[model samples]
Target: MPDQQRHVAILGAGIAGLSAAYYINEELGPAAHVTLLEAAPQCGGWCQTMPQQGNSWFECGPRSFRAANGLETLRLVHLVGLQHSILLADRRMAMARFVFLQGKLMKMGPVSAIRQIGVWNLLRETFVPRRSHSEDDESVYAFAERRFGTGLATLLSAMLTGIFAGDAKLLSVRAVFPLLTELEDTYGCVLLGALCKMVAQAAKAVAARLTGPRRRSLAVAEQWAKEMKRKSLVISALPAYVLADILQASTLHTGANGMDPQAIMVQCVNTLRAIPFSSVAVVGFGLQAEQCPWPRSQMGFGYLIPPSEGQEILGTLMESCTFPDAQPSNVTRVTCMIGKAEHLQGSEAHLVAVAQKALERHLGLCITTGQSAVGVAVETLWTAVVVQRRCIPQYTTGHTKRVAQLQELLHLNAPQLSLAGQSYSGVGVNDAIRVSRELVQLLKKNWA
Candidate 1:
């Protein structure tokens, strides 16, 4: 590694690439020159934000990211001097989550959600010792069901809906929720592991006080181990505490896939392809104030429809309510999403009509009920359909090992090149930023 000017060409001008470029420009100063390339002409990747004549803003991709993911991206946002653009969802709606069950949308408040999913089930997960796979990985459903009950395991499907647009049964617990896997692996039980780890940390701190500098290195090693054991998905929108064990499990390991090296690498890639990616169809609608109605249960950011309920659209975001400044005072922008990739293959007009019908059905709105507004014309609907084909990555079973193998292969075959984005690591905005940060650091070592 040299401390001189270097030209870095980054593929995919998404958030990850852009974040890398930004960090290099600011951190490395003129020592690094970044050329970000994307197959598409535009940047921002799936975090697209479109604004029109009024204050109304429409997003074909993600509207907002979870604040808990990390401060890296938020710091980047401020570094670029875009802090004023930030918008927070209404407090009442922010924590509210909903799922379709028992023939209607049920608010997943603590009482109802605990009753529906059973708190004892989670307790079982916390207390019970679950089996581990030394060679293979487990699906999200299987992993959760073994520790937690089937109810909470299946409920994880709703959370995955907003992410992979795929099924939780198919998602890899080790990949998507690696923190849980590591916890289970370390102590045989996640909760017990956490309790022991905390106790051990306290004991180590006391030892450091007695041993001084000699024990400092041991403490540092232990701290690194603790960090290695905890990697979050960065964009955790749900209650992160509930998913306390789910964290990053990225580490270099071999022989986990199988004994055969070449066959395992091939199988690893095949597994990557085998992991299904769902196409999301988003309808961004600009509605008059009278069109959008705020329901009591729909007070939160938005609601997610579980696969059990079986609906065309995944969920609806109360855009106006969530980001009040994104819309005009006289208008409320509603965002409706259909996780099915092929749904938007139909005519745009047909898609708009279908979305309107869905909004009416799910949210109980009169906007499109005949949409039946007195003087509002049907043409004023101003609906736009965004079909994102395979934008999200599905972390199927064995994903962590597969990713580790892929990294190994890259190191062996293409040492100079690296992969970064939602596909390789976590699929949140902050995840991308963190990946980019790591990438820049690596490049500094390689090209500085």
Candidate 2:
């Protein structure tokens, strides 16, 4: 093959796009010309950080992520030279979260720990699993209730509602929790499947240790460097619908749609309109170290409030406890989230009031109108981060056939393009990273 320079245009500057640029440039080197473009002025779409007063910081999107997914994120952090800045949660101090059941906050405790163990219920949940007759028709709520019983389902529904700001009954189980579905299919019960999976994972870890670090798609530093070089990519790391529009506008020709590509693209984009994201105002209140309500010595992550409580704000995070250096000396940072998508039409003042009430209810802490009493209070912080992702893309009955059709259309019509993102697989930072990496490889093999 000739050493022809491959010019790749990346559409968005989000994590996925940035990661793609890095991979293409670093792995492909001078053989590829990578350009990264953003619709917004800045990079880090949702992963943005802003300075707060007196050694405090605020994250517009994700503050911290668990390292459970593997070393991809850790590698990125180290490659970005943020290793020293990485703050690990104090595991011992980290308390189990609670649900706002009925009207009170109930701490999450194992049945044994809570001293309310139902042996029959536990046995059924552990051994018996519900089987779905249809391939792609079960909702998240139905699946959960079937597998874990009503109590666990209710508890999880509350938590997931807060996470996705979505209706549990409408969300697809396959799209939202593919692993869970797989476990049920393979082992009949989630608990049994998990036990088996854990044993296999342990064996794999041992094998990996013996084998040493395997070659990844691309190193983090290389990816970063490539991202810096690209002006933009034609397609993006955004949802398929979003990319479809861009592709239609671009010079790229899709034979399937023929002369009416733009119209077809619009139809595609409109086919699965994103679930309206709720505007959330995250208010952080800082109190003097002496006035902090929770244990000062015992550092740990904060708690969440379930919907059953009829609370305004979703949850609060104990910033000082969750991350070291999150707050200054003699100051405690409490983060509160208000105005979820479900309540987007609610007034800002109403949201704030609800947040205040929730804070009081959960932590026995009050937010007073005193500058001296409150070190900092960020009101109505603007963040475009959508709360309700059209999670569980409507994979109705015969959804597999539909996806297969779409795949066929893409191959036959738009060979230069590939669909990727949270919608295709799962929604998580790690999942997005994995998909983007795979897409990059696909692009290289086909277009490069």
Candidate 3:
């Protein structure tokens, strides 16, 4: 590089972009100048936290972090100085998640090691393990039924529907569950696959202990280091298609700047457009603490409605119970996600009414008619966030090939550029952080 100090432009100030900026600055020290740009006024795209009256907080998106094996998430929380702010959901509470099935809520307990190894599920696991296909390949329904049988598939349908708000029958299995494909490829049976995973995890634990924490915790640290090495690098963390469009436009200009811009932009656009995404909405409702049906001691994470139930709302998270600071002592917060993007007509009144009814039916709690008024208390607040269209990239069937193509294109045209976000790898926050760190390292090796 001409100089150790370089200026980098990071597009979109979401968690990925922020992580990029933090890494770039930390790795390069004062030598790197990082500017993070967000089309929106604020950063934290879907990870924003809004203040409620009193000492309460309301998350606009991403309410809780899963603690089971979330090293990257823990690292990020510490890196962002939110360790103290981290609230753990009470695991002991009888927080049974209910999936809406056949017009009634069926108790779906939290996933555990034993539950995952049921004999019936194991028998079917050998021949019908969870597998991913290409975009044009088998659908989620087909893949689920094949691996877990119709019963498990039907059971999972509601949970899947709630999370993605997508139709498993139509959604590409490859795009939805890529890990299952890896499990099948590796072990050929879900049970064996899970066993192998357990063994691998045990091995990793032993290795980590033997090597010490410093060596084991380098994924994010190393990534941050790489981003620090680049000058004038653009971190386009938006959806792939959006990045693609920008890249395509840049390719059209004539001149040294135009050519370089066009070449880089084209590569980005092409890579992003190749991935697919699914849109979803999460609508939250606030009820008076006194009116809550479930006792305070019984509170925990809320319920998820399966697709077979044909309910409008996907699932509800016990926001108040999940996070103590999420609401006031006298207030209760319940978040309902409208999973079916196709069914959303984008009407607040309609969404609110649907959510209210679902809550009444499942939780047996009614939302006072007056509470339906907009701009009410945080406990009574309702919000609907719609991702008009998104790319649902799964690590299934030809995922490796598609990623390989993306990598090859980047290598040929924009060697210094890398893509990171939920669309590329995993959808969870940890996944995003992990991928971002990896990309940072790659950028450092090439540009630094």
Top of the candidates by TM-score: 1
The TM-score between candidate 2 and the true structure equals 0.77
The local distance difference test score of model 1 is 0.63
Q: Write the per-residue lDDT of candidate 1 for residues 190-280, one digit (tens) a residue.
A: 7676677568776863443334421222222222222221121121121111112221122223444345544444544454465455678
- Candidate 3, lDDT over the whole model: 0.60
Report the lDDT tens digits of candidate 2 across residue range 59-84: 65657677775456677677768899
Would you list the C-alpha lDDT of every candidate in the order shown? 0.63, 0.56, 0.60
Higher TM-score: candidate 1 or 3? Answer: 1
Model 1 poorest 10 in a row by lDDT: 232-241
TM values, all candidates: 0.79, 0.77, 0.78
**Candidate 2: Cα lDDT at 4:** 68
| Candidate 2 segments whose C-alpha is farther than 4 A from its true place | 1-3, 109-118, 126-129, 196-233, 239-241, 244-267, 272-279, 295-299, 339-343, 346-350, 369-408, 444-448
**What ranking of all candidate models by TM-score puts the best one first?**
1, 3, 2
Best lDDT goes to which candidate?
Answer: 1
Clashing pairs in 1: 2-448, 93-300, 172-396, 179-245, 179-247, 180-245, 231-247, 231-248, 368-371
Candidate scoring better on TM-score of 1 and 2: 1
